[model samples]
Target: MGANIGDNLFSIFNSMTEYMIDAGQRSVLYWDIMRRRGNQYLEHMAKNIPDVLKFDYELLINGRSLPEPVNYGLLKILPPKGVAIDNRKRPFVVIDPRAGHGPGIAGFKADSEIGVALSEGYPCYFIGFTPMPEPNQTIEAVIRGEAHFLAHVNELHPKADGKPVVIGNCQAGWAVMLLAATRPELCGPIIVAGAPLSYWEGVHGQNPMRYTGGMMGGSWMAALLSDLGHGNFDGAWLVQNFEGLNPANTLWKKQYNLYSRIDTEAKRYLEFECWWGDHVFLSAAEIQYIVDNLFLGNKLSGSEIVTSDNISVDLRKISSPIVCFCSKGDDITPPQQALGWILDLYQSVDDIYASNQTIVYCVHEHTGHLGIFVSSNVARKEYFEFASNIDLIDCLPPGLYEAVIEKINYDTVNPDLVTGNYISRFEKRTLDDIHSLGCNTLEDNRCFATVKRLSDVNYGLYRIMVQPMVRAMTTEENAKLMRRLHPLRLGYELLSDHNPMMKPLEWAAKWVSEHRQPVKPDNHFLQWQTLYSDLLATSLNIFRDWRDMMTEQMFFGIYSQDWLQALMGLRASDAPPRKHPGHDPVHLAFIEQRKKEILAGMDKGGPREALIRGFIYVRIPEGACDERGFEMIRRIRAEHHDNHLSEFKKTCREQFFMILLDARRAVEAIPQLLVGREEAGQKFFEIIRKVATAPGPLGKEADMRLAEIKALFIPVRPEQDEK
Candidate 1:
């Protein structure tokens, strides 16, 4: 009994010593993290002292500031290897979002937008800005600046494929869209990733971030804050808003995650923290324009916002093809917000077609908003496929399509036909298809319309009763102090190297890291620590969900009132139904004229024309199209083209539209295209057969379409092998 008691005491002492050592080590590491973070913040502040971009841009295009103006310039990005661009290759211009963060997140890394384009041999250019906007620089000026930049890019790549494929991330997405709408001739295929064009549209209960604006009153707060900043709104507020959306991430998981895997996660955590902490500021007018016109008023979808020159900024006017990359898991810019504009702009699929526009969308199942742009997996598959097929997308018959990317599998029938690790198929979609994702936004939009009305009233009252007094008391110096005091900013400042309190921490951290005593994974105490962390996170998440639900309920209860909605210019029953622009006589004449031309050319060019027509006919049912089939078309076009690649693309587009308008006549004219080229006709049949069977076995609808096409081309289908 005495021996056992003595043994227990010794065991207790040993355990206590181990606990103390591990605890000491952890405490030192915590201080180390804080110090490193502080140092990083200071470094970022030093670089942004001049507020110039730290991006390693090799070539600067001093944009001719045009009649209006811009303080920013465009630059060509040389890859890390510093390879000179092949001017003859297609030029890829990427515009990084000027939202809160510094530039180069899109390209500085190997797994990024610029990186993908560069690997594909495209001459890559990036549109980035300094920390400061030109005095009184409005959105209009920025748009004009971008237009001139594109013109310069076009001039620089005179021998390259048509025009630069412009890629815009987040805020840049909508900016590019506006630019494309205003100057469609300058853009090739415009890609908008994780951008919310229709802001008021969101799912109920799940997307509660939309309700916060209404619950807290409205844009008056934003306006007042902007006035405080003396015409510049600190972007730290925007980043703060982003943080609030996921408190668990910002408050707990982020720090705890770093703590739990400190040894392995240090480098990555710091890299991301650099981007997250480096906040950028916006002009007061800019944020107001964004909040009022885009977010609250939701005026963009209907072309309510006009250009400086009085042109109505209608999306339908943009003739360039557009590809929207959104994600279902993105709470900020949900698929509904990303794609709801299509429902707003067009009455039907026919309307989209009549407008002579090509809009394709790809909805990722589970990537978050940042992941849509920042994830390497997304860049590898979706972006890589997009870069490879921009030309095909550009030339696709004027219609709506959903570009679907799926992993290639050996089990997929004839997998050898797929050249890459993934296959992207441009399957045609319609307004109804998009509507299925989130058609419930109409009611939500009505509630937001009420909020917008309230904002105007509140803002007017603030201007009259409150603004003068607030402005009198606030100076630029005080405003700077206030911005620095922001919680996100203050945390870094408190933990910074400048703090005398953290002086001893440096020595302690160095010693602890050298003599680290990490807790064992299976330690009971460590397990308890993990359990406590999880319980805290879970409880917070539950509270968040409940809060979201209550907010959603309150929003509907307050704003759903008929009197409130009617007062806000909405109908008692519903908001105004989305409308497409009415077809003007001139537009109708253009369409009639194109139809007439297709009708006239029905019985024209031999085998190639008929073969192309056959292919188009088979794909009338959207599912009939596949990536491998398009790949086949690409090979045939390259092999068969006699002139510039553009000529072949144009020819195919014209022919495809002709067939789309009148499939029976287009198919009937098959023999006409095949006249005097029986050998070519046989080759065409083989190609179509390959296209139909590439992704998988043909379904009934496609098979029937293929059968009709095959019967028409039986004379061309070879009966025996050539000797």
Candidate 2:
């Protein structure tokens, strides 16, 4: 009996071991299947990626052909239709960044910044460039070209109430701000999305990417790479750097997510990759200038940069209202980089106001750098809100504001759409609030200064010793081949059969589709798989955080320690004051004279007239005022018959619809209608302001008239001024 029991136990133990081995094999098979599924999805999506060669808009000039060459030797877009008929008060210009990417990202879809503007009846223009810039085209030339574009836009819409609104994305952000500051008269409000100005400012623990320059011995590598490219820097290198920042996403997570939900996420993956894959190149000079002046030197916001023609660029010189859109979650251009300049340039909030600058900023909680500009959800909320309330932003008092958009409900019967019910409020923000985000990190500044000195020494050595040899060794043909073989570029190019790996993927995809056992969205096994994936992603992020901390500490120890500083001849004192020649008495006099002239002009209208003009310029139409509506204004003026300000305003309120429907035509007809009431238009504004400012609500009739006037003018109240 004892022998029989022992044999039974041994048999059960063997059965258990076999079951364990089978489960382990199944898990391995599941992982393999998931990975293959992801690659297959990517392959299918790659095949459907839109070709970059199509033009979405028709271009026309009076003397040009029906289909003018889409390529302008730089870039082109399908010029948006309805621009001619749409109100030009809110002109939308989308400037795409030329940083390692081709054009059309700003209008890649129907739900982009361009699309939002088009839907709102704002005349939209896209600024794109060709694959190659003109040989002689310098940054200065581009700035001048942009100024010319805005000038042409102004001429096209002579009756527009306000100047053109320019929106710049990424690299284009600083470019547009530079143009606006240089030629402030040509533009109105300026919007910079995802642009970094104060490059050296970042949180202590968060942004280690900025340290890579110092750790890698500064921008000498960029120079070396450009030299190897034979006078042109392949933008693929910059794209590669971006990819290296997130290994898990670039290597596995991105593809795996697509594979696991290939049916649902395929379209989005392709849309993004279309823009990502279309890489462009920059002239060696252009790339060198950007790396040296903007990224490495941090000279833009510091007022240390000079244009090729010796013109100084200063952020404080820009008079137009500036709106900065940044994301806290953006690693490339964090909020600190976007907003640190405010504290760097000015000592106090009063200085900002004294400069007559209207600065507004909005921060999103968790959108990454790319999503800040390209995500559909971001476009719908942030871009849409900005587009709709741009006029309101323009009217905001000079100072800093944090724009907050709050959603509210409305009845369907309301004239405006339901989605439009959300109200946008501008809350005042203190300089301290902005400065709190590590703008006080002067230690980082010290380290970057050391980097600048080292980079200069390294670049000089490279130019003297290595650059000539590199140029001599690398021919244009070899450079082209090298570019084609670059890892980042190859990923896109390889899907073509020319790549051996692609052949198997093609066949494997077909076989899998034919014998597919796709899991449902809510399958138990799939849920477990997703849960495991999330845990893995979290683990990867934790590992990256730890690695970054170690890297940062090492960087600090090497460059920021006292021993290292002493060796480099570094001092703890702040950078020396900028040297400037004493102001020219003659130029100073001219500036004072201009200021006096402006004040005198304001005096001519008085506070009331100035206020009235401001209101009239921004007010929406009260009623259906078309071309023929001016007659009603004439009738009102005749009916009023008196020069009294109150009576003139009364007449205006009674005929609010006529003015609201068409202000341009009404303003033109005001002279004829006010033949007897010469001061009628000026008086009309004061009375409306009084009604708008009155403590209690106006009666129904009065309220209707007030609403009409409000529609015609965006109310600019003293209390609403940035505090």
Candidate 3:
């Protein structure tokens, strides 16, 4: 019995010793990861990485000194391995937000925005900036510079099929919006990913970030910070604010994640940190303008912010198709902020059509703001589908539609054509459909307007009382010191190779790696340790929720009161209704004008024209359009594509608008376009028939349209239908 007891003791002792050895190895591995991360971060920072583009780029235009001088460059991205660009394909211009971080996040990896474009044979261009703005480089100059850059891109890719597809990431989203609005004729389809145009918009209980401008007593502090920086607003402050928004992620979660999976996650962590750590700066005037006009005044959508040349930036001015991509999970630029511009500009769905505009939106169920641009999965799915079917999106009728991307299980789209892994479909949506998603009430508007007014008052007060004192004390050296002392910077510098304290870490880490012992899957202590980490993250998130709840309650409690609102020049019952000018005669004039043009050329079109007209007429009933249907239409069109198709596209687009204006009357005119070309008319009908039958049974509205097409173009013989 004593010998058995001794054996049991020895077994227990061996297990304990193995566990300790594994624990020691893990500790060494962690420090080694940190050491490597520190070295990677230092190297990245030393490189002055701009254009956040991971691929090679040649500088095309320099903003070192010019009339509209800004510290930005227009770069043409060199295609990576296994990818060759076709200039004939639509060119892609990706504009990364210079909010606080440097550019390149959009193109930093092989599976990113630039990557996606390059993979699909599109000539890619990146508009990014140096770390600092040129002397006296205002936002106005920046916008002008960007406009020039795009004009240059258009000039370079003169052979491209359409205008360049401009993608705006975050702050760059608004900049692109300005470009599109100001120079609508220069752009193709616009993709705004996580771009927040309407800054004062948010769900009251959910997105508490909007209340920040109000809670901080307005943008006066921003002005002060800018002045203290000696004319430049450190983008580091912007990065700091982003980090503060998620304490759980910043304080515990991100580091813990790296620590837990240091073996595998080290590279990814270092790569992301390279982007996150290096920040860009905006001129004082630029940041103040952003804060006052956009965040505080909430003026972009209302056409209140004017260009340097006194041109108003009205979204309605843009003629290009716009694709808004947002995420339910993005707290920084929520769906409301990204999409609310539509509400502020157009009062109803018809307004969108009357304005002769097309807006397509796709809301992801769970991607964060950064993920919209950076995540490979998002690139593979959303961006890939978008790049593939851009022409179809461009060809969509003028109105609002929701792009639904679904995973496909079918091996083939047709007998010979293989299906892509995913498919994209646009479903017609109404103004109410968007409203159901969320738009703040007039009362909410009043509160935001009050915040705007208070900002102006506070700005004036700061100008009088604080500006003189700040300007007197501000110096370039102090500004640099403050920037270097920022928490983000301190973390990097402290952990880097330059720090003597981290010297022994390299030697120790190398020794540990050689004698590495890893914890087994069944280790009880390791399992408990993981559980503890989860608890910490959950607890921090819970605290964040509680804190957000309190901030929201305080915001409403203070702003929703009647007497206080009246004191701020708002009436107790002052809730102005947002108007829709769609039904107004002036707005309706465009449709009338289009209808007249269609009627004028009603009898002057060939097989292509007839096909487009008949196809459009058949789709006048909303549910007739499907992704598979569009794809089939595209393939058929490709078989018959010519320079004439461009004119035909315009023709189809005009006719489609006519159908939307008055479907009953538009259908009557279908006979005018198709009656002369009987053989082509029959062919067009067959094409429509194929598309209609593509997605199994025809939808109800589609069935009606199909019957109408058959009535318009009945074949000379029954066998023609078999063809």
Per-residue lDDT, model 1, residue 340, is 84
Q: Which residue pairs come into collision in candidate 3?
A: 51-104, 52-103, 52-104, 53-104
Tell me the TM-score of each prediction against the true structure: 0.92, 0.74, 0.94
Query: Taking the tens digit of each residue's C-alpha lDDT, what string does model 3 give over 1-723?
Result: 999999988876776677788777777767666666677667766776444467898989987655767898889888877887787887999998899998889988988888888898999999888888886678778887888888998898787788899999999989899888888978999999999888877886798889888888789989988888898988988888888778999998898887767568878987888788877888888998899989888888778877767897889989989999999999999988889888878877777877778899999999887889889999988999888878778777788999988777655344333245776778888877778778788788877777777788889999999899999998999999988887878877778677888878888888887887776767666677789988998998998899899988887777777776676687856546223222446646766776677656655665666667776765656442456776677677678666333455577677776566566765666666665576566666888788666655665877887887787776346887677
Worst 10 residues of 2 by lDDT: 621-630
Cα displacement (Å) at residue 586, model 1? 3.4
RMSD per candidate (Å) reads 3.2, 10.1, 3.0
Model 3 regions lying over 4 Å from their true place: 1-19, 48-52, 411-419, 575-592, 622-624, 641-645, 715-723
Candidate 2 vs candidate 3, lDDT winner = 3
- Superposed model 2: Cα runs more than 4 Å off: 1-55, 59-87, 409-421, 500-516, 521-524, 563-569, 573-723
Best by lDDT: 3
Task: In model 2, state the lDDT of residue 93.
Answer: 74
Clashes of each: 2, 15, 4
> Model 1 Cα displacement at 710 (Å)?
4.6
Candidate 2 TM-score to native? 0.74
